[model samples]
Target: MLKELDLARREAEVSSLAQAEQDELAELREWLAAPEGAKDEHRRIAGLRAEVKEWQETYKKEKASWMRAICELTKQRDLQVSRADLFAKQLGQWRDIFQETDLTNLEQEWDPESSFYANEDAERRECQP
Candidate 1:
C-alpha cells in the first residue's frame, strides 16, 4: 500500500510540473504574439507620419511659388499702368500740336496712316511691358 501511495504522489507531482510548464508556455506565446501584432501597427503609424511630412513640405514649396508669382504679376501690372500714363501724356501733347497746325497744310504734310496716334496704339498693343 505504501509503495502504491508513493507512485501516486510521484505521478501527481509530474502532472503538476507539466501543467506549470504549459501555463508558462501560454504566457510566452501571448508575449510573442503581442510584439508581432504591434510591429505592424508601429510601421503603419511611421508611414503615415512620413506621408504627412512630405505633404507639408510640398505645401510649403507651393505656397512660396504662388507668392512669387503674385509678386511678379503685381510688378508687371504696375509697369503697365505707368506706361499707359506716359502714353496718355504724350497723346495730350500730340493733340495740342494737331490743333495748332493748319488743317490743309497738315493734310498735305501728314498721311493719316502715318499718324502718331495710330503708331502709339499699335505699339501699346504689341508691347506687354
Candidate 2:
C-alpha cells in the first residue's frame, strides 16, 4: 500500500507539471497570434510615407505651373517695356525737331494770299471727285 501511494503521488505531480507546460505553450501561441505594439506602428509609418509622397507630387506640379506662368508674364512685360521705349524715343525726336523751329516768326515765311495756297486749293477741289 505504501509503495502504491508513493507512485500515485508521483504520477499526480508529473501530470500537474505537464499541465503547466501546456498552459505556457498556449499562452506563447496566443502572444504570437496577436503582438503587442510593433505591427500597428509599422502600418502607421507606411501610411504616412504614402501621404508624403502624394504631397510631394502635388507640390512639384503646382511649382512647375507657377514657374511657367511667371515666365509668360515676364515675356509680356518685356515686350511692353520695349514698345514704351520706342515710343519715348520717337517723342524725343519730334520734340527736338519742333524745338529747333521758329514758330513766332511764321508770317515772314509764308503769306495766306500767296499763289501757293490758291493753286493747292484748286488742285484739291479737282481731285475730290
Candidate 3:
C-alpha cells in the first residue's frame, strides 16, 4: 500500500511539472508575438530603405551633371586643339616664306629706278617707328 502511494505521488509530481512546462511555453509564445526588438528592427530596415532611395536619386542627378560637364570640357578641348593646329599651319607657311626668300635679293631689287613700292608698302612705311 505504501508503494502504491509513492507511485501515485510520483505521477502527480510529473503531471504538475508538465503543466508548468506548458504554461512557460505559452508565455514564451505570447512574448514572441509582440517582441519589442522585432518592431525596432522593422523600423530600422524601413529607415535604411528610405535612405538608400534618397542616395540613389542624388547619385543619378550628380552623375548626369558630371557627364554634362565632361562633355562641355571635351568640346572645349577639341576646339582648343583645332585652334592650335591652325596656328601651327600658319607658322609653317611663314617659316617656308622666310626660308625661300632672300633678303639680299630683295634689297638689290629695290633700286629707285628699277622698282616701285606698292600702295600698301607706302602705308606700311608711314606707320613704321
Candidate 4:
C-alpha cells in the first residue's frame, strides 16, 4: 500500500507539471496572436515610430517650402536693389545736364541728340509693355 501511494503521488506530480507546461504554451500562442492588438510596449513603440516618421516627412516638405520662399524673396530684393542703382545713375546724369543748362535763358538752344536726351528714344523702347 505504501508503494502504491508513492507511485500515485509521482503520477500526480507528473500530470501537474505537464498541465503547467501546456498552460504556458497556450498563453504564448495567445500572446503571439495578439501582440499588436494589445496596448503593450511593442504597440506603443510602433505607434511612436510611425508618428515620428510622419513628422519627419512633414518637416522636410515645410523646410523645402521655406527655403524656396527665402530664395524668391532674395531674388526680388536683388532685382529691386539693381533697379534702384540704375535709376540713381540715370538721375545723376539728368542732374548734371540740368546744371549745365540755364532754363531761364530764352535764347538757349536745346539739342535733342545731345546729352541725356540722346538716349531717351532707346531707353523708351527698352521699357517693357
In order of lDDT, best first, we have 1, 2, 3, 4
Per-residue alpha-carbon lDDT of candidate 2 for residues 33-113, written as tens digits (9 for 90 to 100): 766685566557557856976896698679768867987999999999999999999999999999999898787777765
Colliding pairs, model 3: none
Between the candidate structures 2 and 3, which one is better when assessed by lDDT?
Answer: 2
* Location of the lowest summed lDDT over 10 successive residues in candidate 4: 37-46
Better of 1 and 4 by lDDT: 1
Which stretches of candidate 2 lie above 4 Å from their native place? 1-37, 107-129
- Candidate 3's error at 2, in angstroms? 99
lDDT of 3 by residue, 1-117 (tens): 547856986797689669868865775566568579776665575578569768966986797688679879999999999999999999999999999987977776676644456
Tell me the TM-score of each prediction against the true structure: 0.49, 0.52, 0.52, 0.51
Q: Which pairs clash in model 2?
A: none
lDDT (Cα, tens digit) per residue for candidate 1, span 54-89:
896698679768867987999999999999999999
Best-to-worst TM-score order: 2, 3, 4, 1
- Cα RMSDs, all models: 28.4, 28.7, 26.7, 25.2
Model 1, 50: alpha-carbon shift in Å? 1.0
Q: What does candidate 2 score on TM? A: 0.52
Query: Which ranges of candidate 4 are over 4 A from the true structure?
Result: 1-39, 107-129
**Greater-TM-score candidate between 3 and 4:** 3
